[model samples]
Structure formats: C-alpha cells, structure tokens
Target: MSPQRFELLIGLYGDDRMAAILSEQELIASWLKVEAALATAQAEAGVIAADTAAVIAGAAVPATIEAGRLWRETRNVGYPILPLVRQLDEALPHEHRGRAHYGATTQDIMDTGLAVQFDAVGGRLTELTDAFGDAIAALATAHAHVVIAGRTHALQAVPTTFGAKMAGYLGELARDRARLVRAREEMTTVSLFGAGGTSAAYGEHAVKVRTRVAELLSLRASDIPWHVSRDRLAEFGAACALLAATCARFAREVVDLSRTEIAEVSEAAGHLRGASSTMPQKANPIESEAVIGMAVTAGALSSALYRIMEAGHERAAGEWQAEWQVLPQLAALAAGALGTARAVAEGLQVFPEAMRRNLGADSGLVMAEAYMIGLAPRLGRENAHDLVYAAARRCRATGESLQAVLSDMVPGEAAGAVAELRPEDYVGHPDVAIEAALARWRDRG
Candidate 1:
C-alpha cells in the first residue's frame, strides 16, 4: 500500500461501511465467492463432480489464500484471476484441483465479484440516503411556517418559508433515493458468460449454470453477457453523480445561509470543530465545505465512467481497465458526500429571529411583489408595476420606508391592502409543498 497525503481526506469524506465494501480483502473474497458459486453450478449441471465442487467451495475464502504470493503472481500474470484460481486450486486436494475454476473466464469472475461489491455499497447508500431524507423531512415539518427572505441573484426578492427550502431538498432527495434503488437493482446481476460472451465453454448447460450461480450469489441472472455493454455501470455512476449534486446543492445552501451577514442558519454548535488555525473567531461551515469538495470530485470521476462506455468490440482494453480505477473512487466520493450531508441535516441550526430580522432589513422592499400583486387587480399589471417602481424610487430618494411611500402614492383601498401585507402573509402555501414532500418520503418508505 502506497502512502498518500490525501488518504486522511478520503477517509473523512468516505463512509467506513463503503470503505469496507470496496476493501482489497473484500474484493478478493468476492472473487472467491464467484469461483465457488461457479463450481457449485457446474457440479449441479453434471459438468463437475459433487465432492470436488464441495472441496473447492470449502476452500473459497481469503484466509486460505496467501495475499503476498497472490499479489506477486497477479503482478506476473497481468491479472488477479489467474493467480486467485491457482491459489484456490492449490488449497484443495489434488482430486479437486482442476475443477476449481471450471468453465468461468477472467471477466466472468471479476465482473461478478464487482457486482457483489456494488450490491453491498448500494445497500449502505440506500440506508444512509433514507436517514438523510428523514432528517430533511423533520426539518421541513418543524419549520413549515417559519418565513425568511427569498433571495434571487444574491438579493432579497420576496418572502419564503425555511420549510419550503428544505422541502425542495427533501423532494430532490426522494427522487435521488428512487434513482439509486433502481440503479442498484439494475447493476446487481451475475456476469457468467465465458470468454467471448457466448458461453461456448459451458455448451448446452450455459443458461442453467449461469442461473444457478446467480442464485448461489444472490444476484440476478443477466439476459445476455454484458462483457462489452457497460451501460449498467454507467447508469449506476450517473445515479451516484446526481445524488452527489443534490447533496452539494444542500451543502451550498447551508454555506450561504451560515454567512456572517446572513446568519439565518448554521451547523450545530461545536467549540473547535470549525475553528481556523490563525483566526480565533472563525466558526466555518466545514462539513458543508467538505461535502462540496467530495461532490466536485464525484462529478469529475463520473465523467470518466461515462467515457468508459465507448468500449469497442467483444471486449475493451483501455476502457475496461479505466473502470477498475474510476468506479471505486466514484463510489467512495459519493458515499462520503452523502455521509456529510446527513451530518449537516441532523445538526443544522436555524435562527428564526435572524431570518425575520433579515426579511425586514430592506424596509419592506422585499414585499414589493406582494404590494404589486395586491394592486394588480386595481391598476392593471403594467400600471401597478410602474406605480410600485416609482414608489420604490421615491422611498430610496427621500430615505422613507417603502410602506410609507406606498401609502402616500395609492388611494385608500389600495393603500390599505399594501399596509396590511406582512412578510409572512406573502409566503404562499409552502406548507402544502412540505406536506407533499413528506408524504412522498413516507410512501417510499
């Protein structure tokens, strides 16, 4: 194992469960599992002796294999499967030696092993994402009516509920959850076709042996050999990228809202968690920042996975090799981003008073839309817009409040309507949207 400066960063960004799923030991164990399942399938199909298959299956574990020897052999052989099969056969009695690998090819063993690893990773990601979604839903429900200034172009435009913002995140997370579940289902299939994907080695019992192996491994049997069709892996990567983007979106909002001037929301209190080295007063949004960093890396890595889809012929050379490096990193980064997002959601701090104070900071200017809407029925849409625009200019020029300026410019009924408008009153039906998001989450659960 080469020492890397970014190893600590990767650990912080990634989940321990995901790390275990993609570990070298686990990867080798998955390969052994595939080999064992293949032996069992061949035995059942009468292609190999039952006692020989049992002996092979019994020896299919990492503990029986010498890691140092396997590594050296793999380096010499240009792939791990040849060495792995050699090690497995060496572990069994001489009678069972030749039956260890049977009809399976290198791609069949490696691809099926990768599918098992991905299945585990997908399960963990689904659980984490569900927890994150629940946290977001709870936040939305708690603050469903808490109004804050809505910003556009980094300036206040109107009033919106904090719950509405969280609800939007929850909704997107819901869709992401569904997408991940589908990707997991699609990708968790056995790749058992030999050599050229025609299963010529297995002959008449190809489909039956493939199906039996899939059952033994708890995976779906592929409709055809996907030795060259990489869409399944690509689709899974795309789902992960979309999930990371959603997490980044939420993290960015937290970063923006936690700004010194905004102060509407922040990470939960921590004495030194976000402290800067030189700046004693600094309490940064470190979790959100880390999440964004992981998300950016995942996005870049996902592009590589997409590029690998351009494989040529029955098998690829460089494109196939590229996935061996890219997929694990992409999975790790995505899982890391999800872990950070979950932490942020569970510990988020909301300051309702600060949100209200900021809403009024512009002296009712943010409520201009409300005033315009109220006046549109009386003055016509264009005329009402002009009237509000002129009042805004006068208020700025005379250093008066927008409400006072509107009171002077409009007649009794229109002025009454403008005077009656509160920032909270203008936050149209965000609770309904929140309810919809919550309902969707519950239904999915």
Candidate 2:
C-alpha cells in the first residue's frame, strides 16, 4: 500500500484517542504542565518564592512557546526542555525569569510528562481490554456447548467447544491486562533526579520538592533515582508488546478460521467492508489483518526499548533520544491493535453448522481421539492408540467413515463406547472452564 493509503486506513481503524494523547501538541502541553508543577512544588518547598512560582506557572502554558522556533532550537540544542524553559522564562517577568524550570533537568520533565501520558493511555487501553474480555466471556458462555474441531499443527486433533477456545483467549487477555496495569503503575513514578542522578543542584529541599511535584502531577514519588534505570519504562513496553502479541494470535486464529476453505467464523459484514479490489465476492478480515500488522510493529519497537536499557551509568548518551521517537509510536500501535481486537471480538460471526460440517470433513477423522480414548480403558493405551491409528489409515485410504472403521475395529466389548462418541459428548467440560474464565474476568473487573 501507498503511504497515503496506509495513513487513511490507520486513521479509520486506529485508536484516535491514543493518537490525540500522544500528539505533538499534547506532548508539548504535558511538558509545560510538568514545568508548572515543578515551579509550584519548589515554591511549596521554599526553594523559590510563591510569587515567582505563580509568575512562572502563569507563563508555562504551551501557547507561550513557539512550535517552529522550539523545534529549531531543539534541533540545535539536541533537547527541547531548555528551549521550552527559555520560552517560559521569556514570557515571565524579569524578576521571575530564571525560576521557570527551577532545579529540574530535562529528563525530569520529559519522564514525568510521559508518565502523565501513560496514565491516559493506560486507562484507554484498560477500557478496551476489558471490553474485549467481556466480549470473549459472552461468547464463551453462549457457545459453551458448541462443539468444534480442536486442531494441532494446523490439522484436526479432537473435539472441543468454541467456548473453550474463547475461554483460552480470555485467559490470555486477562493476564496481559494484569501485566499492563502493573507496568503502568510502576512506570508512572516521578523522575526528579537532576542531571547526574543526584539532587546536588536541588539542595536541601530536593526530596520535598520532588514529592510535591509528583503529588501535583498525580504520580508516584520515588527516592531512588531513575535517570539511568530505564527498566520501568521498558517493562511498560514489554507489557504492551505482550498484549499486542496476544491480539495478533487472536487475529491470526480469526483469519484462519474465516478462510474460504474453513468458513467456520467471520468478522461482521457490511456493505463493501473489507472488499477486495477485483474479487467482488471477497470480504476479507481486514481489521484482524491490521491488528496483526500493528502487533508486529509493536513487537519490533519493543526491541529498541530493550536496547535502551543498555544505557551507561547515570545517563544515556544517544539511547534516550530514541525514546522520544519510539515510545509514542509503540504505544499508539498497541492501542490501535487492541481497539481493533475489541471490534473483532464484539462483531465476530460464528457458524456452528459450518463448524460441525468441517468436523466431519475427513469422514469423522477429527473424532479419532474420541474413539481412542473410549477404547483406552478396555484395551491398553498403546493398543488403543495403534488400533485407532490403523483405523484412521484405513478410513483415509478407502475414503470410508472413521466411525464405521473404528466400530468394526473395536472389540465387541467396547462397541457401546464407540457408538457413544458424538462430538458434543466428547467436548470435555467446556462449561467448567468457561465459568472459571468468567470468574477470573469478573475478579479483574
């Protein structure tokens, strides 16, 4: 696809809320907000006069800074905080000019700004994940008895309910959501250690000022300096990556199940939705495809985040710069993927009849395990396995029904068990598993 086409598609399906939260305007605004909070906190700690802080805070709005000039100076200075502080200082009265940024380093404001952004992003993602989880829970409950073929290595293995499958997805999503919540909580702590990871410039009121600033920003205060300890942020990235990867797994399953040959499930249909350019009959799983793409992109970005953890002691030379470019994109992609995943889950179309038909596709080959397990108690496990294997071979070679071949192959004593091997009866305890998943989801909620 062309860049224009990609952008258009992304805008249509991507998480616009996340896009707005991570936009340049919002980022600059967050930085300014942090600067104002720092000034107010310093005043509270007696590092600066209240009136000076008031003047600085009044001038700390984003409109006081020029975007074009800010970028120009940022390019020259290799950081934007100084340019931002310069503009804020310029906007303040001469007496209060030097007090605009007040003992805080660039990382302090930037990192705290990120925490604010993540607070917003985390809330959005958590909402989406919960929505998706609810959808899966409903599906699992509704389809608790809907038998389907369980496959391994891309081929039919045994009977299983669609509810059980959806329960598995719910379980994975719940775990990912928990990880994201923990990471967001841990990563949202304040970053007020000065340039050298010490409060040398902050003097006696450093801890007080930092704690007050954190409180003002609605973030956690940490005494241990994190100027070089990037693990918390990386943990957040890893959580997002895991969530995206799980979304991709679900999407891939939808894509495979909705294929022309399988036709067991589909994304919701609409007029020309997911329409192919030339094939008039095609209605593709486009949203799921986009989810898979976004997940892959998030995974790749997460690698860069891990590399960032290798920053040298006390400061990152070039690694920190990459964060300005990587983190927002990574977060946006994860949100997009998750938003699309929720849509897919809520609008999914399931064909139980098709699932049943497909289960009998290879002449009841999918139920081979049912027969094996049925005879395992009568015959030894190895003997039952060999018998089912031979019967399966005969059914395949002669195009005969597995039920018929297995019925004739089983000893007379096991004839009753072979006769009872219906797919619905063979789907083991899906209701119990679905209930377990639903219980966990409720607890999370």
**Candidate 2 structure quality by residue, lDDT tens digits, 63-118:** 89898899888988988899888888889877777877777889988988989888
TM-scores for candidates 1 onward, in order: 0.97, 0.96
Sequence-dependent TM-score of model 2: 0.96
lDDT against the true structure, each candidate: 0.88, 0.87
Which runs in model 2 stand beyond 4 Å of their true positions?
A: 1-9
For candidate 2, the lDDT comes to: 0.87
Query: Best by TM-score, which number?
Result: 1
Q: What is the lDDT of residue 357 in candidate 2?
A: 92
